[model samples]
Target: MESNENILEVENLKINFKTYAGTVKAIRDVSFNLKKGETLAIVGESGSGKTVTTRSIMGLLANNAVVEGGTVMFHDQDVLKMTEKQLQDLRGAKIAQIFQDPMTSLDPTMRIGRQIAEPLMVHKGMSKAKAMAQALDMMKLVGITNAENRINDYPHQFSGGMRQRIVIAIALINYPEILIADEPTTALDVTIQAQILDLMRELQNKISTSIIFITHDLGVVAGMADRVAVMYAGKIVEYGTVDEIFYNPKHPYTWGLLSSMPTLETNGDELPSIPGTPPDLLDPPTGDAFAPRNSYALKIDTEKEPPFFKVSDTHYAATWLLHPDAPKVTPPVQIVARQKQFAEMQKKLAAEKLSHPVEEEEERQ
Candidate 1:
């Protein structure tokens, strides 16, 4: 059993899809822990099982999806094994989810407030009038001014950002302990995406809830995550604190991700993307899933699976390069430069903090 400190614990989870084409092994031996009130961002390229891992946690996978092995332990309960009735009861109240597209998740025909109040009324047995009032408050809490008047408006009436705010309002109406946001702002324009991300961070501060954020955007991970889990081909290639993943990445896959981030230095030049497509899940290769694309891949990486070698107390990477006997190789030139840039930024921030002590404290007071 996991503790209250650890809100969610996924252990050796293996999920499969029984499609007409073939049986696809979507999530293989995936394990991670979510601490209370922490944001754990799952970052990877598309089709890397980031969505599938979270969907499994929320009990939202399709009917044809199969749990081949292991467990998703939420508050010491195996969410994967839960019956529909049990999950239905637990979902909105205990584990709320925000999808990539708010327009599709929302009921376009219904009043926004009514939709927001649904979870509160269903889970908490609140009166309709009371829930409606609470729903309006939730909208305001999420930075929506004039929420009371907008309560009767349908989802179609709101802007994309507003619609996502409404979705967030609905997710928080019942005060869930864990919020699984799967690409919550992906579809929005960059400007609106910033607003939504800011809103989410502010809401998280107010509620102090654990958040499992799933995104293909590497940029989003650094700003939002305390820790990050980098997935590739249905397996976690690297798991570590945000600083570790960004500044001192160990895995070749992680290095590739960092090297691919667009910067002013790139100046519209195409960033270094990981070469080769991800492996087909229907027939995953026997060794490291990322071996084929990894420039630093070794003979052993192609013949055997690499264990999670410890990089630090809080960091680990599944790559043969981490082995003591493996030849030491510098990260890609771009990644090294990126790390140096980050270090300088951190030093400047620290100097500023020391030079202007108590300024923020005075503002808070």
Candidate 2:
């Protein structure tokens, strides 16, 4: 559930990368608000600007990248306007990131403990001894056993899962207010992925930090996100709560995403995939970015971009299908069925909660 207090707010963020051929419009007029202590998942295919959007927030874009316009407001401070020194101070201290590959993130020559303690030593200005102690504690917190002894081991000495845990430790060493995890579990196996997700959930509850989780996997989004922002062609096509996104998705791109997920009840051998390729960012379409690929796209979609239409108090979608004059179109059959299943499951959970309210309260305690 999202709180009333917003921790970060990004408004009309437009980003472009300079290249030999032309300027690539990576993120165009992207806007979203993240509540404190809530996990917001940015779900989209590769090259959809999910990573770039988060990178903008971290102020970690490449040298050729240009922030055409926008404001990334964190704690009332405009991050885009911050000096290089200020950004340096904020990164890994107030805002930390966990990259996709642990191997690249960890140093091959450095001891794992020292790598984890470096953030503390630099950001918190703690002594070597104290930082080492805190790093060991963080290692244990992230489920790395024998941390005291293992801390001396180099990155090559640990397994992939352990390396990721070390990366998490490094990210959390300073107890950052915002954690950006860019496809953190993509390289791991299913079992390790599940464990990592559970560990993150537990840690988030303990630290009460806001998270911006970037991923292309809808299944992962379903389990982790409190709110979801579905991006397409560098723009957010749909924004809503987890339940709203899963049960009542409004955008065609979102419907395509949900349909592409493999379900237990799926009878077909092959999963349904979205037709057509994404539009080229170098020459972005004048109207809706997704208009070319959208099967349900109206004439207006090709002529003009649609404004965000309010679905509910919190739910919004930027698509012509939401317009009053547009013909009603039902979502895919699989999604409708999934929504019903989710509704039933919610009812059962509610009944259980009602029957054992004290148990629930005690469990929370």
Candidate 3:
């Protein structure tokens, strides 16, 4: 469930990396809030700064990276201002990260149980016996079977899906307040991906931790996220609720993302893809970062960057198309069709609820 209370708030966060060639502006004025116990999905292309933004929150930015401006406020404390020791204490104990590759995250030399228990011993000052006991319980909670016996097994002993579960178990062992999942399911098979997603949802309900899921897959975002933030060329181009983003998207980049997602009804020889590449960050565009790729871009988009315009109290998009004086342009045909489909589904669900009020009441009980 979602809440009104913001557990984490990022404001005007600008980040850059120093390279031999030049400075790479990775994150530019990116801001979003993660409500307590809510899942916020950050969606974008490869270099759209989805990972960078989350990494900054975890205080894992590279040494060459520069925090040009802004603040990441977690529990009223600015994360950027925290020292290395403070960051070390904050991570794992209060905030945990689950990366995409489980192989890299887990230790090959250590047994699975020891790996999971290490955090408890270091952070919570638990005895080895107590930590191992907690590790076993966590493994079971994450759906690992025969945990008492298999705890002694090495990382290589587990399958890919099992390894990922172990990684998740390790992350949740301490019941961290916030969980940063950076493309956690990208490496798994489709079936395993679904299982992992289901497990995450179940665990979230149990733990009540806020999640920031970073991924390029809009399909995954649609299912997992309570709210969506669409990033493009180091900036958040659109921010809205899941329903608003999927059914009433206002940004061209968002439309492109939605259009590219394949559906059961899709009947094309080739899937639709966004026309142009993402903007180069070494020397970002003078105007709108998405101007060159946006089909309905106005002259103003080429000349000036558009501020986020309010579509609703909760929804905002940065695009010249949202300007009142700009010519009206509808979303792509596929996107419009998807919106209609979603509307029909909602109507059907509403009708079903009205028809089966008794069942609904019983279920509530």
State the lDDT of candidate 3 residue by residue for 230-278, as single tens digits: 9999999999999999999999999999988898888866788999899
The lDDT per prediction is 0.89, 0.92, 0.94
Clashing pairs in 1: none
Output the number of the lDDT-best candidate: 3
Could you report the Cα RMSD, in angstroms, for every candidate shown? 2.8, 2.0, 1.3
Per-residue error for 336 in candidate 1, Å, reads 0.4
TM-score of each: 0.94, 0.95, 0.97
Top TM-score model? 3
Clashing pairs in 3: none
lDDT of 1 by residue, 215-290 (tens): 9888888788889999999999899999999899999988888888886678866777888999999999988989
- Locate the minimum summed-lDDT window of 10 residues in model 2: 263-272
Q: Whose TM-score is higher: candidate 1's or candidate 3's?
A: 3
Write down the TM-score for model 2.
0.95
- The RMSD (Cα, Å) of candidate 3 is 1.3
Error of 2 at 337 (Å): 0.9
Tens digits of per-residue lDDT for model 2, 249-320? 998999999999987788757888899999999999988988888888888999999999999998999988
lDDT of 1: 0.89
Residue 357 shift from truth in candidate 1, angstroms: 8.6
Q: CA shift at 3, candidate 2, in angstroms?
A: 3.1
| Residue 269 displacement (Å), model 3 | 2.3
